[model samples]
Target: MVYTAPGSAAFSRKRGSMADKITAELALIDTELAAVELGDIELNSGEILVGNAGNVATAVTPSGDVTVSNAGVTTIGAKKVGKAMLVSESEAVAGNIFVSTGADSAIDEVAVSGDATLAASGALTIADSVLDGSNVANTSPDNVIGAIPVLYRIAVEDASANNDITSTHKFLVTDFWFVGGATPGVAEDTVQLLNGTNAISEAVAKTTDANCLVRATQLNQSTGMIAAGGTIRITSVKNTNVAGTAYVMGIRVA
Candidate 1:
């Protein structure tokens, strides 16, 4: 209420009677705002004092939290804050949650289906390396190429007799072999090669002397043998005086 400025000064009312009627209505509105213009002066609220400033450019309504302490650079445009929690107990650097372009980066490239469990206490680092199963290729039917563990080669031949050696005969040697004719003892034939079928390896014999060859070697493994299963028998013998023919081959190894 005491603002004088026009035609010089002197509106200083030191005492009070409501400070001399607000110093004569502020010296008649400072002689009409001193002929206006000072950027046309506008004060729409309670406090406005520019010159020796105490900066307070606030326009707060329903919007609250806006704190800038040791300010160096704090620029906020459409500042709207309701719940924005940023807490740090000890180490808080830069504080970044800046993700620029659209829809949260396509929802972070989603593709999560089955099992992904990592209950770690510490060390877990997977960079880049590949070596799946090393080398694995297996075909069915009588497969016995050195048994099984990390197999190398297996192709037990059957040509067309198609008995197919009951598929690669993996270790089941039941000890029984005899196929003799032509004077080695007139006639002797008994072949059961292996029994106790679980993964198969059974054999018997019948020949019309297409070259007569049937022999069984030490073929061993008892007390429940299975490192992949085990058995081996390969024989060949031919002597024709009238009847002679036999062929048997069984080999298993793991």
Candidate 2:
């Protein structure tokens, strides 16, 4: 290989070959780029092209509970943000949550105290059993009322036999009623709830003996407490011909 002048035949030939190779490479690149453009570059919801640390463009998708709007605003679904994503001053304690102590202060791990408490499993509980108007908070639902609903359990026994408050669990007998059943006798008789020999509720008289009607009585005495594994009974004095079911309503306290 001998040195040649700039306009020499060999120099021109070498330049032309170099130009041809560069043009061919550029044309191949253009064809590959066109294929990529025409192919399905479909991305899932909240997916976008992002340049990673390696300076390579990658298709990235948000978590299941996250959404990204076309306007570039990202939204996180409720209960989606975990403690790992939060800023905390130290290791989070069991049942403790991150909170802003004050403006311009580091986020702190604070335990929910007073009326409310959080469990290590992320369950929350309130010390108070009942909620009233005063405890209600102003919320987005407007006039948000917090209430603990009392669920009453029902015990039913046919009039043929007394519904022995035979429940294994302690039940605070609140209300008792009789429903007319098959073959209600001609004459109406008295029905009442009892704890041992003492009557817990006032005796209720049947509306009629035609197997048609009955009465309800609310136990107004503390004697309505049915001890667990204890004998609390319902006694009905209906005639043998009379048939009905007695329903005792109460809440399980234990």
Candidate 3:
């Protein structure tokens, strides 16, 4: 039998066994590190990293109109806001204003719908024409004639005949002038206005001697009003004297 020393082949075999175990453990560690690919790992554009409940990290892509912070809070982009309002191209007309329809994000340009008129110094004009006098909504003197003053003139002869003056506009008799006629007595020079059987001015005496008889000195204190589609009848009764011209003027205010 041979006696083996501490540094013999049997001792070398024990050392070789320990070294082989350590190499096997190092190989296992290398295999796990290669699976992670730490050297080749990179984040793509618009890509982010998120962690799940198990603490496992994962790559995520974000939507174009929104962004997510590291804290997981999301926010919308400015251009992606909903229901933005904008004006159209039809707002250039004069005397016109823009109005928003009840519809969502809808608007239009139109003439002022309020009861507005052109100023004395304003040169602006609307495309809409005057309303007809017969329209019930167009009240006379102001709206019927577009607030314009009008005069209805007729020559009256001193005869026992009634002269009826008919007008297409509703007006207010503002003034009267007897140019060529002499002053007739009461019940002799009579002028009356009727608005569909309603007497606006009844039997007003014209007693100014060859002059204008305004409402100030007339026997009737009522405003001589002629409605739309009404008539004014003037009857001259000569008190043994009949000669001259009578001119009637009225102002329109509809």
lDDT of each: 0.35, 0.61, 0.55
Write the number of the candidate with greater TM-score, choosing between 1 and 2: 2
Stretches of candidate 2 exceeding 4 Å from the true structure: 1-162, 186-188, 209-213
Among all candidates shown, the one with the greatest TM-score? 2
Judge candidate 1 at residue 76 and give its lDDT. 42
For residues 180-254, could you state the per-residue lDDT of candidate 3 as single tens digits? 355444436554444444544444555545553533234232547765566765555565334445455555545
Q: Pick the candidate with the highest lDDT.
A: 2
**Each prediction's RMSD to truth:** 18.4, 18.4, 16.3
State the lDDT of candidate 1 residue by residue for 91-148, as single tens digits. Answer: 3223222233476553122222223312223333333443222223332324544432
Error of 3 at 140 (Å): 6.2
Instruction: Sum up the clashes in candidate 3.
Output: 8
Listed per model in order, the count of residue pairs whose N, CA or C atoms clash below 3 Å is 13, 4, 8
| lDDT score, candidate 3 | 0.55
Worst window of 10 by summed lDDT in candidate 2: 134-143
Model 1 per-residue lDDT at 244: 25
The order by descending lDDT is 2, 3, 1
